[model samples]
Target: MKKIKTNVLRLLDQQHINYETREYEYDDNHLSGEHIVHQVDLEADEIYKTLVLHDHHEYLVCCIPVMEEIDLKKLAKASGHKSVEMLHQKDLLSLTGYMRGGCSPIGMKKKFPTYFQEDILLLDRVAISAGKRGLQVILKPQDLIQYVNGQCVDVIR
Candidate 1:
């Protein structure tokens, strides 16, 4: 299979960051995290999904394991927002330059404060969207956090 390149992959290369990519089969109509993990063959804990949320003033990004859910109250406190809600699906592409299932923390059109689930520190490697669907980038969790200027916080439920 041919390697696929995306904004996320290119940015990692430009920064000389070490990472690997996994391509999987996907259907546009069924873009669930469960399907992604099944295709990539990684434990749910090692695969993360990016979420974009806002408190009306600014957008915040969170990367949590596929099997987990974000605790909005905790995220609000961590991000210093009184409340936060998911960014609308319609605004995701224009704001982040990626679709719902393909949003990666890195290489967004504009940098936003990013957070990763604290437990990610326990994993040696993690897989995140490659800024596109059906592909993932595997790298050290710390490296990913550092690149996105993200901190690990208790954002998962």
Candidate 2:
């Protein structure tokens, strides 16, 4: 079997950002939250999940702690969009260069506006997708924001 290359790590290397990748066997049936919690052995509150949304015209990426749900209205308001909805699986893959369960906050096909729930910044280090299932990278939340040029907002319900 061939190993898949993770664009997340590639981008981090290109930017000279220090990150460490941890991998395990991923079960396709597991929800992202479950995978982060069980496979990665991280608290659900400290693991952030990336969600792709489209406001009909433009795409946006929202990162929030796994235990929280996204507030579409808040996200729309923060992005200055009239409305926001979750992107379809196909659109998500096209936009982020990742599949539904594998989307990472880093290494998007194009740099779209990104926003994160402000509370995530309170963590010294958090785990996020490493561009694939069964893999995650532990890094400071601030470092991720700086690297992605993401705006911090209270976009989680």
Candidate 3:
């Protein structure tokens, strides 16, 4: 099957961002980032998962390493909201034009404010979903932060 050119990949190409795309077998058993670690043969620290959250007022994008848990309270404060809630699974496609497990921080229907764990900057490169299953995009953390205009804050535990 031909690989799909997801919006995330196209956006990076359009902006001339340096990145590497890796494809893996699509299987429900290997869907989680932890399982993906073995499939990609990369450490958990080198993979970031995209999460969409709503701070009561607006939707926000949160990226965290696969093993890390999001500290919702800190995220809310960092985003200047009283509280933040994970978007319902049913709302994922409508709110962000992304299906569950295929969201990318690079290209969304609406440019929701995005934030990442501060520790991501310490890593040289990280892998994120390429807006599609079976596709992974690897890029420098700093480059992703700049391209997405994402804030690096302490939002993960």
Candidate 4:
């Protein structure tokens, strides 16, 4: 198979980050992270899904394990927001320049305050969207955190 290229990959390259890419089959109905984990044959917690949230005035980005859900209150506290809500699906593309199911924290149109679930710190490596569906980038969790300037906090329930 031909190697795939994506904005996320390019950004990692520019930063000289070491990473590996995984390509899998995907369709509109099968974009869920569970499906990606099945296709990639990795532990569910090893893969994370990117989410966008906001506190009306600003957007916050989160990368959490696919199987876990964000604890809004915890997220708010970690992000120093009075409260936060998921960014509407309609606004996802316009705000991040990436579609739902393919939003990666590393190469957004603009960087928001990015956070990773503290669980990620337990993993040696983690996988995240490569700025597109059907692909993922696996890298050291610390490298990813540093490259995106992301904080690891207990934001998941």
Candidate 3 lDDT tens digits, 53-94: 996678999999988899999999999999999999899998
For each candidate, C-alpha RMSD in Å? 1.0, 2.0, 1.5, 0.9
Instruction: Give the 10-residue window scoring lowest on summed lDDT in candidate 1.
Output: 26-35
Those runs of model 3 whose alpha carbons end farther than 4 Å from true positions after fitting are 1-3
Q: Give the per-residue lDDT of model 1 (tens digit) for 25-99.
A: 878877777888888878989999999999988999999998889999999999999999999999999999999
* lDDT values, one for every candidate: 0.92, 0.84, 0.88, 0.92
Clashes per candidate (backbone, < 3 Å):
0, 0, 0, 0
Q: Give a tens-digit lDDT track for model 2, residues 11-105.
A: 88788878776676777776757656777666787788899999888888999988789999999999999989999887777678898777998
| Residue 111, model 2, lDDT | 90
Q: Which lDDT tens digits does candidate 4 get at residues 1-157?
A: 6788899999889989999988888789876677888888789999999999999999999999998889999999999999999999999999999998888998899989999999899998999999997889999999999998999999988
Clashing pairs in 1: none
Tell me the TM-score of model 2: 0.91
* Candidate 2, residue 17: how far the Cα is off, in Å: 1.3
Error of 2 at 39 (Å): 2.1
Please identify which of the two predictions, 3 or 4, would achieve the higher TM-score against the true structure: 4
TM-score per prediction, in order, is 0.97, 0.91, 0.94, 0.96
